[model samples]
Target: MVNKNAGDIQSLTRMNQLYEKLLNEVDVGIHVINEKGKTIIYNKKMMEIEAMASEDVLDKNLLDVFMFRESQNSTLVKALKTGKTTKNIKQTYFNNKGKEITTINHSFPIKEEGRITGAIEIAKDVTQLERVMKENMLNKQNGKITFDTIIGRSQLMETVVDEAKRATRTSSSVLVVGETGTGKELFAQSIHNGSNRSRAPFISQNCAAIPDGLMESLLFGTKKGAFTGAVDRPGLFEQADGGTLLLDEINSLEPSLQAKLLRVIQDKSIRRVGDTKDKEVDVRIIATINEDPLDAVANNRLRKDLYYRLSVVTLFIPPLRERKEDILLLTQAFIDKYSTLFNMDVKGISEGVKTLLQQHNWPGNVRELEHTIEGTMNLIMGEDVITIQNLPGRFRSRYQAEEEPLVQGDEGDLSESNQTLHEKMTKVEKMYIQRVLKNNGHNITRAAKILGISRQSLQYRLKKFGL
Candidate 1:
């Protein structure tokens, strides 16, 4: 009888261990509370997410210990009262640092021998996903904004945001450098909006747009007879006084104009056409260049002195290919915008369409993606899915060929026919084991506990799998 009882105890212990391993392997965070609302069992992720230390969470009130305000009116409490599973409960809680965090919580009543015990709650952090949702909300509210309206979110963009934020606190000349369609104007607008000069006028001028002969008159105020086009007109520099002046493609200006621009940036003064005297102006200069200013200087296309004056704080934006993550984000944003404009119920791109979108390199970056989405919507009909078939011929050709070749075996049998089937499933099993290890941040002891296996057993498997 003693030997029989020992065998039964060992069997039960192994079963319980397996149950724990399954729970911790899940991506979501889970916790259990007793009838007294005290946390009895919780996964490592649940504790770590709440910034708790050790296994001290056990036997403590889940709410008081975690210091979570939502626990007071928690849906988990409601689940415990009614003994019903709460399907979806959304709540936001602030961390110790006061940063708001949003999570989706699902709770189920725990039962013991057909009697209610306490409750189990699962929470998933939807912060990034929630941001996408909110961005969609904002997009619909303001349809006028396009990819051109917002700055990028790449590391380059993050640096630009940080610099713009810092620049807002001070008055400095900021130079934005990038290829055409790189959203230099968008950065300028963001900087202006973030600055104390937001209320002030934000005037912009394209130095390359104006004729070389009328450049002086267009930049500085002119007397009545200053030039053929001038009739007592105040130039852009004076018009942008006490505000920001965005000089688009500043490198395209003539070398003489570059010298004049340098003088204005240095002295905060400008000279009108046919007028020798200078007038004081307090405009903050922000310039954009599509080419390297150094190359322009070396080629004698731009003045060296002016390049230094305008480039006090230089920002370089990488092309779209370098930041592929932003491609789909910008694409979706544009699609949402154009959908409303065209008055179509076209919801979104199909999975195949999305795959094709990612596979091809976006040469034109955000601008090309925007135009492609718009063009696709216009040419395609109905509320049907936007498939790769609907894409432009040029874009479609990029993914026309098969992605991967099928494998074949000897005797004309398909390679899959000779597969080991269950044996070959080892790859997936090993992958899952490694994922669990990673989820536990490679803490072997904790991973073993969560996996419901002895630490020694887990170590043995790790060596067998060479993980």
Candidate 2:
């Protein structure tokens, strides 16, 4: 109905092109969510930070793409709800691909003539940087976690730790394979600290959190005039030349770029995005994968040749469920940490809470346990010990589901043969004691230490069990 001319359309298209260039050129991530929590605009840098395609994110509810624990857990969602600015906040969440992503974000509401319209968030991916930078002061204010900080008493963990310590002795490329929250970056930082390059820089980047279109330039740097507005810049490799460069989620990188990365690793040199010549670099490469490297290789997510090269020194961190013995120990450590920080008198957890914690599968691994304790700490109301009531509702429900039979008449599964509660508990205790004993090579003191019981009590149990 309105008069629309070709020149007006051309001008509008040019303005859109300019805006698009701005979104792509900026280093920081930009995400704009509508009032309804749907993504209206997600820029290239945001794509890099989230490692999501525009088609995957745009026009979809932000909550659908991310597995944030709560609806308010999303800064953009929170901004929309509160209509307030949130700055310098650290957010940890799981993406659709199941990779854990951590970011430092600044979020604020966007308004049109004093009326709330949508929310915008500027983010910097700190998925691995949070380990070294220790920037997440929002919740527990945790700092760098070194080898000494790693809590591993189980044989599986001890073996992995010993192998990681050995990798520090050499600068050979190391591949740390583990699930999310298993502390792959923590091990990487410890390796760097123990290595000869401790004094130099330690840089970390999550390949899954970066877009492949910008991956090459970010990793290999760019020269002036490489494109319009391109400036001569040093890539992560050069910045970490004298130190360690940790590439988290390495398999997320495109195959073409992976091949280039392989070339750089092989040659110890890198060619900038537009530079004609290659510059030699001395960097210790450490790469991590959330899933099994073999699975990644088979799925073609990771190149087989690159895997072989980078895995010259490989370390696998077992998930939390595999080593339940560490759960209580880690819980206490977290309690001590948070209590010291909050100055709360939370000395210990109740027996019921302990049973529940140990019963939990901890799909998020150690990180989940840490946060569970942290969240519980915030709920403490002059309680000396944490109880089942203090746990989050979801935790309580899950624990209940595990303890009770889903069907009312499934008694055979739990109370088979009309066994008494004490007898069943004692059976579980004896089984655990035997497993710990075998794991510790039948060492009494060592097993007792792991079990958090006195050596005398352990001896008494052994005598009673006739083992």
Candidate 1: give the clashing pairs.
21-451, 221-235
Q: Which regions of candidate 2 fall more than 4 Å away from where they truly are?
A: 1-144, 401-467
Q: Which lDDT tens digits does candidate 1 get at residues 163-205? A: 6667666678998877777677777877776777777778988
Clash numbers, per candidate: 2, 1
Candidate 1: list runs displaced more than 4 Å. 1-153, 402-467
lDDT of 2: 0.84
| Candidate 2 lDDT trough over 10 residues, lowest sum | 410-419
Tens digits of per-residue lDDT for model 2 on 43-105? 998887777899999999999998875533998888988899999998888767655578899
Best by lDDT: 2
Candidate 1 global CA lDDT score: 0.73
